[model samples]
Target: MATLNRRRFLALSGLSAMGAWLGTASVLAAERDAAGLLPRNLWTSPRFASSPFTVGVASGDPTPDGAVLWTRLAPQPLEFGSGMPPRPLLVHWEVAADPQMRQVVQHGASLAHPELGHAVHVELAGLLPARPYWYRFSVADHHSAVGMTRTLPAADAPVDLLRFAVAGCQHYEEGHFTAWRHIAEEPLDFVFHYGDYIYEGASQPGVRSMNGRPFTNLRNHVGEQTYTLDDYRRRYAQYKTDPDLQAAHAAAPWFVTFDDHEVDNNWAGAQDQDGTPSEVFLLRRAQAFQAYYENMPLRRSALPRNGHMQLYRRARFGRLMDLHVLDTRQYRSRQVPIADRTQVESPARSIVGAGQEQWLFDGLADRAPRWHTIAHQVSLGNYAREKDGVIVSSDDQWSGYLDSRRRLLEHIQRTGQGNVVTACGDAHRHYASDLVQDNRDSGIISSEFLATSITSGADGQGEDEFARNTLRHSPHLRAVTDKRGYVLCEVTDKHWIGDMKILDQVMQPGGTLSRWRRYAVEHGRPGLQEA
Candidate 1:
């Protein structure tokens, strides 16, 4: 499949591959036509008070020979409709082999429609494999900040090292995205954002206490809760406007997936936690999905259809690792209360749905790789807490889907699939544990590293009371810390190493950071060993 490009990947994926390919072809064709009509330096239309690249530029979902370049034309980002006219605008983009913008490899024009908030998603192909490229977009005299992106190595290439950062849960109101600032400076190939890019809620001022501590909200989301497409789009703009978050996006290519906060909190399938009817909830979901697709650096294959988006896909890092990005919230059953342990283990419950579950299992069973990294949203290992001497579990995570979790673990055990690691988000705390079927000391099948939130917890104390409770209760939990930060990981042929980078504070700007801990797993091992 050396000749395979982004278009052909869509063609070989699933039953909808043909339709997806045609849609991608149409987008590329439009880009080609616009490029033919207008030169990169021309087309100066005075349509804005300032430059339209307010949210900055990003690139994601890279292939061996291709990558998706993204930018939204939002001069007045917080305003409705992002301060753009109700018409389509043609934007020019270019990919260069160097940072100086010389030796241009691919350049084209993509029409940015107002319906999608004038966002440009250029699906570039036919470039050199396993290499870095500089990209930028231009509209008239407005030039976007240049972003760096890289394509994956050939599937059979012998890779020496792969470095990346895992991060998620950036609640806009709680604190600043200082962790993202630190991530922007890291020397890494890519960043895996495991969801919760934005929070959909009515903002409140002042302090809110959690774990017996007073935490303040320095910023807030504007307007009412996000339900309509315009609301969601504006919400995304609010988060994307942060300079730190934009720097992280501009730094490297990212692999992203959504958790609950991208839509409504604790939403399951078509059911909302606030008891909105399925039909109504699905309508809101459709709007949210459309806005998410518009603002994100994603390929057209992830375009929303009605209320659903096919976000579960794979990114290969040569023969070193195959990162399987999973979507758990979209197809989950309604969440049970944490106290209801019996019902939580019901056989009918599923978090990743049947089709996605099968797809992941089949991918793991296909062949042996040095690492099988499951880019999941929530914790896979059980994190039970001791409350009044009684152990209780969170219904929001894999603990609530015992049967489903068992199936995946069983597959690993049965296939002897070692070197399996789950890079997870949510829960707002850093956790590392072993995925064991029964006792913590017995039948250890895999390892999981749950990254803490980027800024969701607001100047959090280290290893707060809740984490202490969890560490005391769950023997499988190796480490737990309450901090605002991201996780850095480096993969070699023999050892997979990870470091938890914690920020000193996020309530204000220019916070300090430190590496909290480092862990490693050997190529033939399934459990984590402290480095």
Candidate 2:
């Protein structure tokens, strides 16, 4: 059955698009009236005790014309209200052709309202396509770090080379974000963050390590699980303070989506894991969605409306690939235990519901790009294992909803849609598997490259027993690992290749990293073969 998330939220908002950010540009527009009078409560010459740009700058949701430039002015990064005054600040931004901002191309002013966490989202438009640009934010005497961003090629343009990285599941207290530093150094067009960006559970007590060595939280931070708007905002503020994460955001634009941890563990639609009433749970969800939009570089279109936020959208990288970012948590049926085999394939169960399923099917029918990268959040293959002498699949993954999985696969097989590649996370482990129907005999219809994590498992041991056994028993499964790293993807007109970048350790700084495995799928092929 479908969820009551959107319907209930829409009733509460009495509007759509959140209405908080949609009027931002208009407010800025009204700054100069007919008499050239400055707006009221606009902070122009305000000064801070210290630099407020400690969280750094970022850009995302790029288009051929422009992208969204993001930054929050927070001198006290850990405090509520961001420790800023209860007024709007007139922030100035610039886009230039050089790192030093010598050749200025675009410039504008935006209001960083206190109601919106004192964050600025400048959705720039009317720029040339397929080119690099540098941006920075300024207020009074303080300036944010110069971040590099680029516009994508036109949707109809042909592409020869496309490079990006898939990464997610970054638990802050578990370990350091060393891998983000590595990602910041890579020459990539963009990065796809498939979620678990923040862990919602409270931190552990103390002294959990091995080998007579002590592995402590990088910051030794202590906090409760996030529930209110301030809680989520504080959590994000803490995460954004990481220099490595800021570097990655400053390096390239990112396409991001949330998973269970962004709200609560294993949350499905209107239902929570604890069986809390949907009415009460949706209030917390509304707060979480609001917090997410404030911290990320999302467009005004993605603003939260009550409890719902529109995150399922697509972008085309020339004619090479079309990225369909999915929101698998907001509208789906409640998950049952793995033992409920009788309900696994029932028509009543839907992971994406009907509306999103149709949207996905229609996107697959498009004949434009050579590849369709379906960005997902959970294991989508048959991750079944022996349970009480019976094979049971995961309730949180696609295998638990066989009818939904079968419909997606059967659509691909029916339409002969080739060169489909999926990037999924939330498993905290790397998996390279072939996408087949619920019945394994239907053959491989697509390929999945599961990005492991940034530091979730705290220096995970490579090649776990599950990998060895699953690789042996499951023919559709190609490779598996427990390394704490991301996946690097390089696509050409003829083929697509993914390299699983492995980190030897993440509990300590300066851990060594390398490419441990490589897989390739040809332009028109469906299965992933080791390269």
Candidate 3:
């Protein structure tokens, strides 16, 4: 490794982010082994470290040729500063063609800056498409565990099959992450964690007891609601230390987006549920955003800038699928009271914002692939509950943004588009619904499959009155279940199959899992059918 100039290192840190790449685009454009791309002075320091890869390694935002590799140096994951001093560390990384890690393809050294929680994000370019790559991190002689990631198929190539898992809403204190452990064992090409990776609340005790031990006595959040950067960082560290969550990350590359719990419960665009002043909440939001970016294996494009983050982006899997990942919370109107939500269906009400909505429209207008799937945080279909024999719209979901929802469905119907499906999270229970212009008989414009929580709802009953009443009032909802698990999706040219994997219990270790239900949406078809 080469030496780094302290002055130049400090200068680069002050630059602003422009777009897909960071402000240091010039450095990223250089050759793989180019010196100064990352500060290397820390490699020779008397304070050089060992065992820095305590938080494990992760990779995400895979493209046709490459992906982003992530790892944070933390020997003491729960401690302040993660047991590192206020300085950068020289972190070496590599990409290999095989799991044995012998056929090295790409290798480089980068700085794990203390400003970013001693985390190193290495974005690699110029690798083969539609193939798996293995990666790992090293700080001096201490090596991190190997992680596997795969690049998407070439944009124009024809793809035959793609398999992945969809999951989210993992509250740490609720129960063990048995769902993620099972998901790790599946043969998946990728994973979708659609928000709520960490809940933004103080831990609850005695409310949940597993294996005869009360949760209050087991573990809890380190502080009050996360209001500072340190609070959010420590909270994330606590959740990331879970062995099962780590195992799922090590299994395959992940594509992630955030929901309410990531920052605060039911926060909408610059507004907190409890009405904290915008100026004050913006600072909290900034801290939460930074912590989220530091921990996840996200590309620089998703990095936080000036109290905001860009999360919505597009990914492709050859000609078989085009995924439009959305950010529903960042640019949406505040949640309205149930009585007023239905009346506020004006064109001004937006869930995806104008720019992102236009992007979605343009993507749909273009010649599309066999499957058009929207990966978002909330349910798109109408989910009603029976209150005194009256069905009411859910204000927190898409139903509240009535005009936008209608326009989206109308656009699909006008274009005669087919095979449009949505993979959703946030709701703790599993729900499968058909998206239509109005009622179920109005014709299905799209389909939605909601993945249940990983551990947010501990030891959930397989069936409950909530499910029974929801199904009774909402005809479009094909299936509903109260369980903790994920949804496995298999996409082929002719059919898209979804398997709802439900866990019997999350309160204990080694919870048993089973396929609760299976649904299929055929090519040129809009709604889901029993597989």
How many residue pairs clash per model?
Answer: 0, 0, 0
The number of the candidate with the highest lDDT is 1
How far does residue 326 in candidate 1 sit from its true spot (Å)? 0.2
- List candidate 2 segments past 4 Å from native: 1-31, 34-39, 208-218
- Please give the distance, in angstroms, between residue 243's alpha carbon in candidate 2 and its true position after superposition: 0.9
Tens-digit lDDT track of model 1 for 1-531: 124244532432221222223453455445447543222332246466789999999999999988888999998899998888766556777788999899777776666756567887888777778999998988877899999999999887888999999999999998889999899999889999999999999887787786577766688789899989889999999999999999999999999999998899989899999998899889999998888899889998898865689999998888888899999999999998867767787779999999999999988875646788899999999888888888898888999888888888888777775778889989888898988874224467888889999988787889877888898888888998989899999999888888988988888888899988888888777778999
Ranking by TM-score: 2, 1, 3
Candidate 1 clash pair list: none
Q: What is the C-alpha lDDT of each candidate?
A: 0.84, 0.83, 0.82
Give candidate 1's error at residue 383 in angstroms.
0.8
For model 3 the local lDDT of residue 278 reads 86
Q: How far in Å is the alpha carbon of 200 misplaced in model 2?
A: 1.2
Task: Write one digit per residue (lDDT tens) for candidate 2, span 1-531.
Answer: 113254432232221122223343453444344323333665667999898997899999999988888999898988877778877667777889888999878776665767678878888777889999999988888889999998999999989998899999998987789899999999999999999888887876677673235666655444698998888988888888999999999999999899998899988999899989999999988888888888898987788976689999999989888999998999888998767777877889988889899999999888889898898888787775555667665799888788998999888878786778888888888999888876657877988898999988788778876677667666688888888989999999987889999889888898888998899998777898878
What are the RMSDs of all candidates, in order? 5.7, 5.4, 4.7
Q: Name the regions of candidate 3 deviating beyond 4 angstroms.
A: 1-43, 46-50, 208-218, 341-343, 439-441
- Off by more than 4 A, model 1: 1-46, 439-442
| Winner on lDDT (1 vs 3) | 1
Q: What is the lDDT of candidate 1?
A: 0.84
Ranking by lDDT: 1, 2, 3
6, model 3: CA deviation in Å? 16
TM-score of 2: 0.92
